[model samples]
Target: MTRPHTLLLAATLLSLAACNDAAPSTADAGSLAATITDAAAATDVVTPADAALAPDDVPAPERFSYVPMGCTHRVSAPVGSTSNFRDDRSTFGAAPDPHDVHVNWPADPSSTIAFLWRTDPGTRATVVQYGLSPTALDQTAVGSVGTAGLMGNQVTAHEVHVCGLRPDTTYHYRVGGEGHWSAVQRFKTGPAPGRTDYDVRFVVAGDSRDDVSRWRQLQERAMGGMNPPDFEIFTGDAVLVGFLQGQWQSWFEGARSAMSTVPFVMVHGNHEGLSVNYLMQFAQPQSGVSSQDELYFSLDYGPVHLVVLNDTPLRSDYEGDVLGTQLAWLRADLARARANRARVPFIIATHHKPAFASSSHSDEIDTQAVRRGWAPVYDEFGVDLVLNGHEHDFELSKEVDGQGREVSGRRGTRYVVTGGAGASLTTLGAGALQPWGAHFESAHHIVEVHATMTRLELTPRRLDGTVIEAGRISLTPRAP
Candidate 1:
C-alpha cells in the first residue's frame, strides 16, 4: 500500500543507472514507475504541475487541451521515444533547456510583483492577467519594458516586469499567448521592508545532469513529500552545454510539481555559461543589483537578505568580481543590512561553483573564483552562510570566521557545497578536508536548507529519499 521511503544513499543511485543490480524495488515504486512510464509514452497533454517531461519554460497547458490555430508557435521538437524513463532524449533531436519564467518583487510588502517569461517568436507583446481569486481574472497588469524578445535557435524569449503589487499577497497570473493562457500560476511578494517575522522556503540544488532520476527523487522529496518548499534556488549547472537539452528539459518538467507551486530563483552556474542556449532561453532577475549587464542581484525575504551572482565573469570584471561593481553593490547592501540587522540578521548567497570542494576537485582554483573575489566581504561582514553546487558530492565545511580560521564559540560563516544533486561522484578524504568536515557523502543528492533566527539546518538527500548528510550551524549578530 505504501512505498518504501527512498534512501538518499549511493546504492539507490546505482539501481537507477542500472549500474550494479536492478534498482532495489520498493513495495510500490515499481507499479508507480510503470504508471509514470505509461504516461510518458502517451503524447497526450502534460502541464507544469504534474512534473512530466515537457517544455522547460511554461508548464504544459492543462493536459489534453488543444490550442487554437495560432495558440502556440510550432517549433521543431522531437517527440520522445517509447520509454518510461530516461535522462537524455539522445534518440530525439538536440534537446535544450526550455526557456523559463522569472518572477520577483521587493520585500516592500506593498510592491506589485513582477512576472517575466520567454515565448516563441510568433507571440506578440507579453502581459500577465492575474487576480487573487482564479474565477475573477479581472486584474490586468503591464510591464515597463515594452515587448522585448531575444532570439535563439527558433524561438525568442519575452521579458516583462510588473509593479505596485501588495506585499505578501498571492495573485494568479497567465502569460501572453493566443490560446488558453499558460497554466494559471501564482506568487506572493515578500513581507514589507522592516517586517522580518514570516515563514519562507526555497529549495537549493545544483549540478543536476544525467541522473535525472536522482533529480526526480529530489523533486519527490521536496515537492511530493509531506512539505513542498516555498521557492527554489538553482545554484547552477542544472545541465551541461552540448548534449544537455534533454537533461535541462527533464530537470524542468520533472520538477514542475514544485516549480508550478513555487517560484524559482535561478543563479548562473559554470555549466550555464557553456550553454549559450540557456542564456538565450531563460529570462532572469535582470535589474537593480542585476541591472542589464550582469546576472547578480540582491533580494529580501522575511528576515533574510539573499544575494545571487555569476561565477564565470567575476574574474573578467574591469576591476574585480567581488571587489569592484559587485563589491560596491554588496557593500551598499550590507550597509543597509547593518542598520537593519535587527530585522534581517541572515545574509546568504547562492553561486554555482564551490570555493571548497573535498573531492576530485578539491585543489582546482577555477572553482574558487567566488572565494577569490568575495571571500573578503564574507569575512568582513560576517555573512551567515553560502550555498554552492559543482562537486559531485555533498559537504558542509568547518565553521570558520571570515579570515578562514576555524571558530569555536560562535559568529562564523558556513560554506556548503551540495554538488551531489546529480553530477558524477568522486573519491574523497584525499584532499582539502577541513576540520569543519562535519558531513560528507560521496553520492548523489539534493540540498535542503532550513533556517530561523537561531540557526541553519542543511540536509542532503541521497537518491533513495534518505538523508546522506546533515549539519547544523548557529547564527548570531557580529560582536561590535
Candidate 2:
C-alpha cells in the first residue's frame, strides 16, 4: 500500500508537470524588456508547492551522501506542509506590485547586479528598466522564467542581470514586464574593480526562523541606521523550514524594505533542509570548488572580501575527504584574498555554525565540524573576522586560536556570533562562558561592522535601537 507521503509526492509531481508549460515571450521593446499587461491580469498570488512538505529532487552528492549524522531507520514522513504559513497583508505595498523582489551581487557590484522576483504564474515575462534618472530608464533588460518546487505547487521565479553599469554611480530601477511595474527604487554601486582604500560597511545577522515579528523589528532598525550597510549578509536560517515556500513568503514580506534595496548575501543554515528553497531564491556566483553544488561562494565589496561557507558537514568523512571539499576551497580562496590584501585588506568569513558561541550552543563542549575543519584555515590564512549564527544570542570571542588561546588582532581571528535576529534569545548557562568570550548578551539584535584601511569596528545593537556593545580592532599591515 502507498504511504500518505508517497501519495502526496505523486500529486506534487503531477502539479509540477501541469505547470511546466512554456512561459509567455519575455520580449519587450528595442532593448531586452518585457511589455507590460493590464493590472487585472498580473495579480501576484501566493501559492504553496505541495500538500505535504517533503524534499524535492535531491541530487546525489558528488563525493558521498549529504545527510546529517546518525544513520538509522529512515521514515518518509511529511516534514510539514506550507499551507499553515501564509502571507496576509502585512508586507509589500499596493496592488499589482511584485512580491519577493530582491537584488543580489552575483558578480562585481560595480558592473553587474542581479534581480530576482516572483509573480503570478504565466505572467508572460519579467523585465527591469534601470537608469541614472527615475523618469528616464535608459537601459532595459529582460528576465527569464525559472520554476521552483514551492510548498507543492510550481511557481514562476524571474531573474534579470543588468551588466555594463558605471562604477560608483547611483541608479534607479523598477521590475515588471508587459505593462505592470513596481515603484521606482534606487541603489548605489561600489568602487571600480582592482581598487582598494574605499571604506566598506555591512550588517550581518541571522536565525530568523521562529519569531518573524522580532525579525522584522530588528531588520527595520538595522536598515534605518544613519550609515546604512552597503549590503546585508544572513549568517543562515532565514526561515524555519528552508523548503517551505510560505515561510519564505512571510520572511520576504517582513524584510521587504531592507531587501528590496540592498543586496542580500546568504549562507545556508542546518535548518535549511535539502537547500532547494535556498538555491531557488537567489542566483550566486559559481566557485569551482565543488562540482556537486553552489553551497559555498565568495563576493567582494570595496576593500572587504566576504567568504560564505557551508559549515554543516552534510556529506561524509571528516579527515580530508568528502566533507573536506569546502575546507580545501576555503584555504585556496583565502590564500588569493590574502595575497591581494592591498586591494582587499579585510577578509571576513561567514557561515551558519559558530566556532565559539558561548550563550547558546556551547562550542567548547560540542565538537563542531566547523571548528575542527575551518578554524585551522582561518588561523593559517589569518582571516580577520569570522561571523556566524546558530546560537540565538550575541557573543564576542576574543582573538583566539582553535584551543581558545588569546591571539593579538594582528595574527588572530575574532569570532562574532550575531544570531539574535528574530529568534528567541538563549541565556548563558552557569558554566557556558569560555575564557575567550569577551562579551555575551541575550537580546534580539543585529551586528554592524565598519571596515577601513587601518581598522575595523563592530557594534551590536538591539531591536529597539540601543547599542549593546562596541569594539574596534586595529589593522596590521600585510607582510611584504
TM-score winner among the candidates?
Answer: 2
Candidate 2 colliding pairs, count: 13
What is the per-residue lDDT of model 2 for residues 242-351, given as tens digits with 9 covering 90 to 100?
54566778888888779888888888675554344565567566554333244677877777888987754332234543246777788889989988888777788988
Q: State every prediction's TM-score relative to the real structure.
A: 0.70, 0.77
Candidate 1: tens digits of C-alpha lDDT, residues 1-480: 111111111212321221111222363244434433443433332211122222357443321111112212111111111111111111111321224454543223235344544443334344567778777778664332111111112223433445556777877777653342566777766677766556555577876755666776777778766556666787776664311233455666566666644666767665543222354334344444311233676777766778876655422342455446676777777777666667776788777666655666544554444665676677677677888776667778777765466776546677887776666675574754655466677777676666555455566677777766355444564543
lDDT of 2: 0.64
Q: Model 1 segments beyond 4 Å from truth? A: 1-112, 116-119, 142-154, 242-247, 274-276, 280-283, 287-294, 314-319, 429-432, 474-480
lDDT (CA) per prediction: 0.53, 0.64
- Worst window of 10 by summed lDDT in candidate 1: 73-82
Worst 10 residues of 2 by lDDT: 28-37
Give the C-alpha miss distance for residue 157 in model 1, angstroms. 1.9
